[model samples]
Target: MAQQATPVRTARLGRTLGQEPTAVSGAVLLLPGGQEVSGRRPSSLLANASVRALGRRLARAGRGEGLAAHVVHYRYRGWNGGDAHLARDATWAVEEVLRRYGDVPVCLAGLDMGGRAALRAGGHEAVNSVVAIAPWLPEDDVAASPEPVKQLAGRQVLIVHGTNDARTDPELSFRFAERAKKANREVCRFEVHADGHGLRQYRDEVTALAADFMMGTLFGRAFARPVRDALAAPPPLGLRMPLAAGFGASLSW
Candidate 1:
């Protein structure tokens, strides 16, 4: 007889980035964007205005859908340029959630570099869905080498990017979504009109979209036709993405 693989237990440890927990069967793990070397996990973890905005919306929506929401503070400070440290942190967060909540389903939402980590880690058995908001990509890169595009197989994935994003190319996100579609039938791409890399204009809408996607996928919460149609819409013409305003000042990472 074939033997079943042993389940490895991860140590439960890390800072809670936001919001109180609830007795729900589902959980959402939110990751904020920042670099590794800045030594600013405190500020970068959940202080970003956009990340907090998303977290608030997710919490509200998750409450309605009976999914507990939590954010993670990385034990380490950086991504290490696509290294495993941040991904390891994410794995730890999921395991902790499972330990506390007892095998509940999980969804991940991340911005920029955090989005990259989520995409790389989304294929894990614990993650039911992933929403990548304006994830960063190396310049002119293909999906095969470092993008982890294929790892999203067998998962529902959503990639939301602004047409005017200057920090990361929206086309790369679109291509990553296409590659993910080859293995996962439930892949979606959303384009925000006239927004920048920070999604400055429609932060609330983006958060709602993520919440809707998470609720729809994990809890059978059906999205309105307008929501579905907008997610499937083509990229609209928009303003150029100006450089972000005072990144370290506003976010401290």
Candidate 2:
């Protein structure tokens, strides 16, 4: 008889930066984007470099307030459809945060497919907020299933997308935000004008906005006026709020 093959175990890892994990009051788990379908190859370091940089920036910005940041290194390099591997890895990261930091609140921040994963994993008890940047959403089709919004009911959710993002449809994210807002009034979205999926044009502004939201949600810092206004406003106004220039400089943080 031929010997049976044994499954290989892949470990999902997280790189923690800024403030000692044990001493931090809050945490943020950063997830990076990946392909739609691929095998169990380890996530690429080059692909996750931007997210790691962002994590460092966030850690530095929030260091005064005892915030620690982590970048999740996924076991796989793709979404893989119904397997939802990335989402599950994000949840695992949240659980890991809880294990290391006790009861501190956590924010899930992701780009592209990671953004979708962050939103999908927002329901974890330790996660208090979610930030999705240029999240990849599926087009409406006979077999396509809508993303779940019920898990986001009690979480503060923010979705930021570039109007000119050719890679991921901004309209799809807007529609997802609409459904999510109906389920949870705290949900809102911001549009980066003339930007692309990378959001490189207004990187500082985007980073500032994310920092502001995370601080507000995790440390009780008051949100900037535009953020507060967007959260309070209804429908198109809130969901389609434009990210203004010099917005990052305007913040007091």
Candidate 3:
């Protein structure tokens, strides 16, 4: 054999949640929404090819902001996929991002089913940020998310959806807000007009919220007056503002 070459190993720059290394303050995990649809992977939420392209566009935006955001797409193994798998995958992705980055913040965002997954994953210790747009309720027509879910929270959340979105209905956003209130989680929600499920109304909000949410989660929230409201009573909107550590949002059209 000729002279053998050694593989080069790099240090992580971003935050770590699992065993992988992520780039510094640059990488974000974008999990596109995939519902139970007809596909080679039926259990996966089918956000469609168009949505996939949108993810790429978001990734570019992230890069433009000096953040290295990448989109991750995968199919769950069973019927009507649940957040359990989404959570697992997201956690793994976070570690990978951390291994690459070292100490920078890591964020996760999604639309529809993916939105729900982002919340589920953000609740874990691994995630430092999250964005949920028109998330699907765990139960049929449920207004607020369950108590356990509401409690397991962290990072900032930017919930944006159309007021007239026929797929999930506007009332659902209100319900989500209520649950966030109960959980005493900080959040921010926006109700865009005529945005519908495709989110055609406010494109700029997407980029702005993503950056703002990350900035707040990474550097804001600590020096502010502490949150003292009991978990039993309703949560104030400010506590659930669009910014803050482990924050959340409720955007409706």
Candidate lDDT values, in order: 0.68, 0.88, 0.53
Residue 160 of model 1 has an lDDT of: 83
Better of 2 and 3 by TM-score: 2
- Report residue 45 deviation for candidate 2 (angstroms): 1.9
Q: Over the stretch 31-132, how does candidate 3's per-residue lDDT look in tens digits?
A: 656554322342223443433444455454344344665655554521244335555566677777667666667667777766766777776565666767
For residues 1-253, write the lDDT of model 2, one tens digit per residue: 9999988655455656765544779999999998899876654678788787778878877888888798888878889999888899999888887888789999999999999999999999889999999999887666777888899989999999999999999999999999999999999899999999999999999988998899899999999999999999999899999999888796666
Q: Which 10 residues in a row give candidate 1 its minimum summed lDDT? A: 244-253
Ranking of candidates on TM-score, top first: 2, 1, 3
Please, what are the lDDT tens digits per residue for candidate 1 over residues 1-253?
9999966533233333344555667888877676744533446434455666676777776664466776666755567764556677777788888888788888888888778778887877889899889997554445536466667777777788888888888887776666666666667777776789988677656766677778877887775454455334443211112223221122111
TM-score versus the correct structure, for each prediction: 0.77, 0.94, 0.64
The candidate scoring highest on lDDT is: 2
